[model samples]
Target: MIPWDLIKGGMRHHISEHMIICRPVSENTYFVLRLTLSYLSTQLTWEEM
Candidate 1:
């Protein structure tokens, strides 16, 4: 199984920005997407940032 720490770290650093931009599409989907994106962003790098 994937390590939770790694997964959470990735989302906070990488995917949060992407989800913030996607907010206008749909509220319900946006919420879910934001959660997933935020979760993935934490594991990204400066290049990804």
Candidate 2:
């Protein structure tokens, strides 16, 4: 029989691992979106000038 504590610990570890993997991806996506938005804004301003 499996122990409840072991199952809980494994689930917790899995969740933490997923967060570790996803954290960088989400951060990179945010960074890219910010850069793209800034670039687009600059282009629009230049066209207006």
Candidate 3:
């Protein structure tokens, strides 16, 4: 039989790894979107901003 702690630790490690892999791509897109929105807002009027 396997230890419960080992299973939990493995699952935790896997979730952290997935987050590490996915977080950067998401963050990059979010940052770019925010920048684009800010730029457009500056170029446009306050109503759209």
Candidate 4:
């Protein structure tokens, strides 16, 4: 969970680093990343908890 928060916070940094390295990424990979990030970004309300 700690690592996940770090990645979420440094999203732009990671994107820039990836671009600098010019690594090829698949669409499926990005989709999964966005999906997980979105899912994690939700705030849990007391009622939900």
lDDT of 2 by residue, 1-49 (tens): 8799999999999876875687878867777899999999999999999
Q: What is the lDDT of residue 33 in candidate 4?
A: 93
User: How far out, in Å, is residue 31 in model 1?
Assistant: 0.5
Q: Kindly report which residue stretches of model 2 are placed more than 4 angstroms away from their true locations once superposed.
A: 1-22
Count: clashes, candidate 4? 0
- Most accurate candidate by TM-score: 2
Name the candidate, 2 or 4, with the larger lDDT value: 2
Clashes of each: 16, 0, 0, 0
What are the C-alpha RMSDs, in order, of all predicted structures? 12.3, 12.0, 10.2, 7.8
Model 1 lDDT per residue over 1-49, tens place: 8799988899876666665575545655867887888777765654486
lDDT of each residue in 1-49, candidate 4, tens digit only: 3798788769978776775577546645776798887777654443377
As a TM-score, model 4 comes out at 0.36
Q: Estimated TM-score per prediction? A: 0.33, 0.55, 0.46, 0.36
Model 2: residue 30 alpha-carbon error in angstroms: 0.4
Model 3 CA deviation exceeding 4 Å by range: 1-22, 46-49
Comparing 1 and 4 on TM-score, the stronger one? 4
Alpha carbon deviation, residue 16, candidate 1 (Å) = 19
